[model samples]
Target: MVFGFLTSRRRAGLRAQPVPPEWRQIAERNLAIFRRLSPADQEELLQHVQVFVAEKHFEGCGGLELTDEIRITIAAQACLLLLHRETDYYPRLRSILVYPSGYTAHGEHHVEGGIWEEAAEDRLGHTGQRLRALVLAWDSAKHGALDPTDGENLVLHEFAHQLDFEDASTNGTPVLESHAEYLAWGRVMNEEFEALRSAEDAGEPTLIDQYGTENPAEFFAVVTEAFFERPHALRRRHPALYERLASFYRQDPMRFVPIEQERERL
Candidate 1:
C-alpha cells in the first residue's frame, strides 16, 4: 500500500525524529504491547507518538494536572493505532479531555422512529459527535496499557471509534481503500456481528464480550480492544475476525512474540 512510510521503510517525505531516551524508558516501563513490537516498529510508534502529542491538545479534568508521563503514555497508545498507516493525524480531532478516572455524563440517543431517548451513563471514554473532541479516563487508559491480554483498552477502543467517525458515523466501519474491501468487510463483519449477537443471546462463552452485541459501533470498539490486548485469544478462537481487523489496522498484534518479554525487559 502507498498509504504511508515507516522509518525502516525510509520512504520519502517521512522524517521520523529520534524518540527521546527518557520517553523510551517510560514507554517500556508502562506499555507491555509496545515492547513486544520489533525495534523498528517501536521507532515507528515513537515518531507517531511525537506527532500525536505535538498536534493534539490534552486537558486534564477533575482537578488532575497533565504531565509528560500522562501525555506520553496516552500519546503512545493513540499513535499505536496509526502505526505504518497513512493518516492525517486524526484530522477531525480537536482535543482530548481526560479525567483521573471514569466519569459520568447525561446524554440522549436517537432511537427507532426518530425518538430521542435520555439516559445517564458512566463512561471510561467517548468520542465527540460534533467533530470537536474526545474524552478518556486516565486511570483506565493507564491500566489498559499496562496489561496487554485483558481484551480491554480505552485508548485503542476510543481511537478506533475516531477512525470510524471520520465518516461522521459510528457504524462499525471505517473508510476502506477500495470498494472490494468494503464488500469483504461487510461479509466478515456482518457474519461475526450476527454470531456475537447469537452468542450473547444464548449467554454462550464468547471471545467477544457481550457488550459488543449492543450495536455495530460498540462491536468495532470492543473488537479493537480484543485485537490488541488479547490478540492470541482472538486469533485462536476468531481467526476470521482477527484477520479482518489486522487488515484494517495494517498490522498484526499476534505476529509479535514473547508477550511476557516486554515485562522482563525492564
Candidate 2:
C-alpha cells in the first residue's frame, strides 16, 4: 500500500511538472553543439533537460557561489546524454554539486617509496570522494564543455557515473533490458576493456583516455565521454563497443559525425 501510494504520488508529480520556455531555449542552444544527433534525439534531449533542471538542485561546493549561468550550463551538457532516453535514465542522481575549483582531500598512505612507507596524507585520488552528488570543479566543467576534445569534462564524467549506477552498483555494468542483451554486452565489453588495458600497458597512445583503464566503472564513464564527444573516433576504432553504446544510449552518434578524417577511417 505504501509503495503504491508513493508510486501514484511520483506519477502525479511528473504530470504536474511542466516544461518551461527558458529550458526549451537552453536545450535548443546546446543541441547545436551535438550536430550529429537526429531531430528525434534532439527533441527527446530537450525534454530530459527540462525535467532534470527542474528537479535537481544545482549547488556550488567549496566557498564558490552558485549562479544561474553555471547551473543551466551544467544541466545542458548532462541533459544532452539523455536525449536518446527518458529522465528515468538518471533516477539515482538528485543533485549536482559544483565547486569553484578542484579541492583535495586526505589520502590513505604517503608512498615515499614502493615499500616501507609510513601512512601520510597524499594528494592523488583525492577527487574520488563524493560527499554529494555530481560534484564538479567550476573551471574544469566549464572548460571541458567548451573544449570538447580536452577529455576532462567534470559534468559529463560525473553524470556518466550516475547513469551507470542507475539500476545497480557503480561497477561499470549497466542494467540491460533483457538477459540475452546482458550476455552479449559482457562479452563485447570485456574484450574491448582488455584491448584498452593492453594499449595502456604498452604505453601506446589509446584513442580512448587512459583513465578508462582505471577500472570498469571508470572505463564506462570515460568511454561515455568519448561516445558523446568523439563519436566518430570511437565508432571507427571500436565499432562493436560503439554499436553497443549506441544501443544503450539509444542514439546513433554515427549519424552526427562531423570530422571528415574520422569518418574516412570508419
Candidate 3:
C-alpha cells in the first residue's frame, strides 16, 4: 500500500511537469498523428508520455544507441492507446528493448505430430506476458510514427500485447469495464477473427492483416494497428469490429482526420 501511494505520487509529479521543448519538437517532427490530435488530446497524450518515459526502463540492443528521441517517439505512440482511458502505464511492462533494425529471434515452432522445430525468424517488435518487456526495431518504429495512415504500426502492435496480458493472459480480450462489454467484445472479436481466417483460407484480400490469423492474441494486436492507422477502411469494411474498438479505446480515430480528407476518403 505504501509503495503504491509513493509510486502514484511520483507519477503525479511527472505528469504535472511541463513537457520539454525538445520532446514537443520531437513529436512534431517524427509523429504525424500527434499534429492531427486535438489540442486537449495532445496535452493528455503528452502527460501520459511523461509518466511512461519516467517509469519504463529503456535499453538499446544490437549496438543501437538509446536517445531521448527514440524514447519519446515510442512513448508517444504507446500512450496514444491510453488517451481518454484509465491507465496504469502498462504496469506489467518494465523494460523496452530497442534494436537498430529488425533482429532475428531464434525459437521453436510446433511442426506437426507433437513435434517442435527450432527456427530463426526476423522480428520487428515483440512482447509477452512473462517476458515483462517489449522489443522494437527503431527503424520500423520511426516509420510507424511517420506514416500514420499505413495500417501498420510496430509500437501499437507490440504495446497491444501488453494490454492483452493485463488480465494475466494473452487472449484476444483485455479487461473490459463491465460484463456486457466483455460479452460484446468476445462476440465481436471472435467473429472478426474467424472472418479473417476464412478470408485467408480463400486467398481473398483483407483489410486487416493476414498475420492476425495466427491466433486470438495476434488478432487483437493486428486489429489494433488497423484501428488507429486505417480507421476509415476498417470502419467501412467491418463496422461492428470498428465500433467495438472505438468503445474500448474511447476515441474515434476518424475524428483525427481533417474534414476534407475524411470526405475524400469516404
Off by over 4 Å in 3: 1-3, 258-266
Off by over 4 Å in 1: 1-15, 109-119, 257-266
lDDT of candidate 3 over 1-266, digit per residue (tens): 12478888888899999999899899989998899898999899999999999889999999999999999999999999999987888989999999999999999987999999999989998898999899999999999999787778999999988988888988988889999999999999999999999999999988898999999999999999988888887888899999999999999988885433432232
Which 10-residue window of candidate 3 scores lowest in summed lDDT? 257-266
If scored against the real structure, what TM-score would every candidate get?
0.87, 0.78, 0.94
- How does candidate 3 score on lDDT? 0.90
Q: After superposition, how far is residue 96 of candidate 2 from its true place, in Å?
A: 1.7
Pairs in clash, predicted candidate 2: 36-256, 61-98
Residue-level lDDT of model 1, residues 1-266, one tens digit each, is: 23344633443223356667988988998898788789999988888777777668999999989988898888899889888877766767989998999998888877778899897889898886575788999999999989877777889888888888877777899878888888988898899999989887887888777788888988998999888877777777788888888988999887763455322210
Each prediction's RMSD over C-alphas, in Å, is 4.7, 4.5, 2.4
> Which segments of candidate 2 are over 4 A away from where they belong?
1-40, 86-89, 107-132, 261-266
Task: Report lDDT (Cα) of residue 226, candidate 1.
Answer: 82
TM value for model 2? 0.78
Candidate 1 C-alpha RMSD relative to the actual structure: 4.7
User: How many clashes in candidate 1?
Assistant: 0
What lDDT score is found at residue 59 in candidate 1?
97
